[model samples]
Target: MPNNKPVNGQKTPSFFDLIDQTPPPPVLELDSKPGTRRLAKLRAAWKASWEEGGFLYQRWEEVLQARHGSWHEVATWIKAAALFGGLSLIVMMVDAAGDIASATLKGLSAAPATGAGDGGGLWGTVAHPVQVFLADQAAHLAVAPAALYAFWQLAGLLGLIGGFLGNAGPRITWVLFGIGTLATIWSAAPAGGRAAATGLAALMWALASIFALRGLTLRPIVHNHPPQYQFNAALHLHATIPAPTPASDDFGDETDNIHPLQR
Candidate 1:
């Protein structure tokens, strides 16, 4: 028999007593049903996705609200417009290049033979290709409306550049862009499936024109009225002035000395 008595105001330790004092291991209760487990996982994923989407929307709203009436906002709009305009210009250039290449190839393929006594001299050799290329281009232009559309795009590109460089007037830029827009729309009739692309190009040109006009008008005003700090002479003089005599009739008046009556 083991002795079970208090030692120094503490109970004597025993194996069974220690076992009873120890905390039990936590029992994990897992759902055996796959449906419930899957539902729980789906619910958790949805909640996380909702929270992330909300956070993103909140940040976007904050960004949109932060820069109103600022130069940064104007710059962003101009940059966006310029980007679209540049893309449109690139597409136009590529289309023009393709057309020119096709016409040149066709002309060269159908060039006259350079046989003996065929008047194919040094000058003829050089001028023959040029003549053929120009003839091909003219024939294609006569049959297709691409010539006018290409001219419009070229003129609009020049006007856009000039406006940005401050070398062109607003009215000229507007006219060029207007002509380009109409040409783009007119040319779209020939582009069966590519009409959407032409419309986008026209929209880009319009956006560029609008923002260019706005920038041209706003830049001078923004540059002219710079922020200025107005110095208040009275505020600086407050510390230097002596305290007023409590008994003086014109105690707080700084100009009392200047007036003979007050003095």
Candidate 2:
């Protein structure tokens, strides 16, 4: 964004006011998975989350920038997708190889222990429960990477690509969450009361839900307030207040700084 401040005589709304005015992105309530119509659910979740400002999005953006300076560029994200695909293939190959090695070792051990005839091959090997179990587990292990790539990892990549250009949503979401959290704590003051305990419990549940499942984190009640109000009232405490720069005397005077420790 350019640094053109509003000219004189033009009033500008504060960030919080803008947050109150802005509507969250559209969302789908269904659960999602790969190759299903439910995939729309993932799209909705990411869109909604990207819109709601928070520290999580900031950290992810930092990571994206630090590793790939051009993270904001489409070409960079595509390259990332390619790298992830290559790694997934390598992981799948290794998993399959390990399964094969384990099966071979187990088969050799079983053959000697059981003395159940030599080289009868597939049927003979599967005749043992141990072999059957290994084969079944191997089947699962073999497909694990491919499944993760097709579903979760691929979904994450898409989310990154389609993410909001700014962190405004998460920022506003967190700001509201912070105000609600402080109010909750203040109301629950006096250490060991039922109100305090109850508030704490709700806070934990709300946090777990917010982290495990993405969405707006705060809900309070009023005639025309947002949806956060419909849920637990006192549960959203998070922030990003920048620290002030150090003054010369913020630390003890340097004149006597070295003497005390040495003495």
Candidate 3:
């Protein structure tokens, strides 16, 4: 330690003053290290996901507690089923639309040839091409049927969404599903495997329709409510009694009746 005495009326250096004079330690650049930045980003993402998941879990817990014995759980499952069914319908619709588009484009590309080398009038030319295009569309039997199927699928998807949001009644969804199931079964080939697969699909559609109807019916009844509590008479009986006041000579027995035991 250096000498602490002041020289020539100079003020003595305190411990804090000495600390202030000390140089700060060099700060290491953690970001300069390989993989440090990537690790930090991953950690931040994980922390955010964890927080979000915890929040969702807490909300789910609250819902379960508030609606413990209600039909809410059944309704939730039905909605989930409807969502999955809608996804399937969407996929089928996309496939059908693709087929229709491809067929239509092929017919149009070949349309000019059908009207070529004709000495007919302008009306004849237009009429001839339209007829040819219709004939071409008729040749691909699958296209028309696919278009119809796609339309029904779209209708069913819309009904499912609308019913889920309470914008449409359950009957509409049920009707669409019923139509889709019938069409699916009707279109099934007589072949063994194909018929079996189509039958399975129709069964699924029927089940979805039933669940959708039930879910919509229960929607109004399956809502959250404040927890109900009943008054506990037994708890009131077990409550602690008040202590008795001490008898005063000046106010003899003035408070004796206030205590239940003394009374």
Candidate 4:
């Protein structure tokens, strides 16, 4: 039978037809299947992202245009900047090394003090501080290059991050630096020189740690300053509990007197 309830003078709709025509009751799926829902959404997003001329394609186009266009213009600039940085580092290192080497060479070449305080108390006292200063300077000079070189190692690690380099190469570099730092620390002498050498070792150690840990600690840092949050003064919270919440009647008086049969 057709749906014939006077409006169109058609035959009455059969029970089964009416049932079939009715929309299904919205499913009340109470199960909180977060993983299923999340996975489904992720799959849909992935597919949509890859759709012809979609978000992924548009991003690729933008990147390609930038890389092929402005990138070339700045290519020489990048190389120039890098070259200048490298030359500057080399010059500084060489100057530092030369100063220390020349000072120490002169000291070593100086013939033993003649006349009075030769290899004795007064002369030793006078020369000790000067020798300390020179030793300190040399170690400090070594530290300068060591620090920059460690930073350079970290920079090369960018290749690892960018997927251009493999784990083996960086790992090897880290191992070599680590061993070298250990050796330097072991052989270093004099208080000032040792202190500066320690700094170099520390830098190398930091670099090695960064490489070993895969720079996970270098994640983008987000700084949030919520209006109600205070970082400096609020760090060490000094909260005191209320002097016992004054007792209050939480329940009504009617509950004070009740009988099982009252209901």
Candidate 5:
């Protein structure tokens, strides 16, 4: 009797007593159990939740908003372009003057034995100075004009290539300037004209290059200004919308049946 009967007995072990004897394993340790498989199911559910939320779409919209807002920031492209153009013009003038000085000096001292050689007279004195001045000025004019034309040609050519390539890398302006410099050098190939023209072209190109570098360094200003709301407001104020007056006859009663013109 003593062996068979339980001390302070309940009829059998209750659910609470059994739970107390053998508690559930911890959450972290549940993954190690063959029967549990909690972590695997949680991971699958998490992936499903993320997919339902359209995470990629949300990321793209964020990027779009940033770009759109940035467009509204003050644009300096026009100012930069105008500055570059002005500097280029000034450089062209300077280069022309330098070429003129160099050519005049060379002409005075080193006469190249022209077709007209005289024994001695007023004609030689008068004609020689006049001829030299005219020739040197003409040569100086040649420098700027030729360089202009050559760069223009190169711009057109590279513009085509740039169009095809789509996105040329950063420092695109530098690349174009380099190409222009090469073209200027190539165009001034003939001997005497070459030296003066190349020197002047080099000076002009250097100044332009400096400006172009500044343009490149600055963030590109895009023309993406939103349509002016003031214009729309003005239109709304000025424009009159006709109110529907009471229609005469049976058409008023059949208003629901009547179809307005489909725009």
Candidate 6:
């Protein structure tokens, strides 16, 4: 009789087998056969990748942070730029008006002294002198280069500053935005209304730019943890992550592991 009973120290059936047969573990496919040569190549590639990938990831994160920092800093600059632009435009208008008025008064004052000799003489002499003076003055005023120059120069400057400050601060940016919007509208006004409208438009643009600046700083608030994301590493802080689902028996269980995060 062959041995009907099992030999001593023989392995027993697994618990799962007693209930129902379990499937064999699946084999993993690898790029190379198991050996020192394969491990050497893998190790070399991993080392190189770790060095390069870590550097690249860190640089990318740093670049993102720097961009955000620059944007925030720019917000403050916008408000100040808008205010300055508005003031500049106002000054140009006042300067031009004063120049025109002064030129007119000087022309009138140059009327002749002989005009005082007779009731009619005063009027007659003064009229000729005033006319002559005004003709010369008219020649200068005809060009009106100063007004045009000042208006265009200041108007352009304001437009530039307003554009720059458009994303700078909240209140000032709003002000600048208003100024810009109004200025744009005024620019298209009728010819007779153009000068004043143009000035107003410049002023509006500057003011509106301030508000636009503030808008640039606006970011959607995030309130979830890890409130911000860090890349290429595990989060170390106490925070919530999507809970992992229970794996099936067919899927082998793996331990939950934690790793350090580098900021």
TM-scores for the candidates: 0.23, 0.19, 0.25, 0.19, 0.19, 0.17
lDDT of 6 at 27: 35
Residues 2-84 of candidate 2: C-alpha lDDT, one tens digit per residue: 21234355433333343344454444556233444334444444454354342234335646666655545534445787789
Best-performing candidate as measured by lDDT:
3
Pick the winner on lDDT between candidates 1 and 2.
1
Ranking by lDDT: 3, 1, 4, 5, 6, 2
lDDT of 5: 0.47
Residue pairs clashing, model 4: 4-10
Summed over model 4, clashes come to 1
**Model 1 weakest lDDT span, ten residues long:** 110-119
Candidate 3 structure, TM-score to reference: 0.25
> Please, what are the lDDT tens digits per residue for candidate 4 over residues 149-181?
334334435433432233656555655646654
Q: Between candidates 1 and 4, which one is better according to TM-score?
A: 1
Per-residue lDDT tens digits for candidate 6, residues 166-251, read 52333453454355444443443455745654555555455545544444556788776663656776667887899999765633
146 Cα displacement, candidate 2 (Å): 35
Higher-TM-score candidate among 2 and 3? 3
* Candidate 5 segments whose C-alpha is farther than 4 A from its true place: 1-170, 215-263
Where model 6 places Cα greater than 4 Å from the true spot, the runs are 1-74, 113-263
For model 6 the local lDDT of residue 104 reads: 57
lDDT of 6: 0.45
For candidate 2, the TM-score is: 0.19
- Per TM-score, the best of the predicted structures is 3
For candidate 1, write residues 222-243 as lDDT tens digits.
3567559876667444456789
Per-residue error for 135 in candidate 6, Å, reads 24
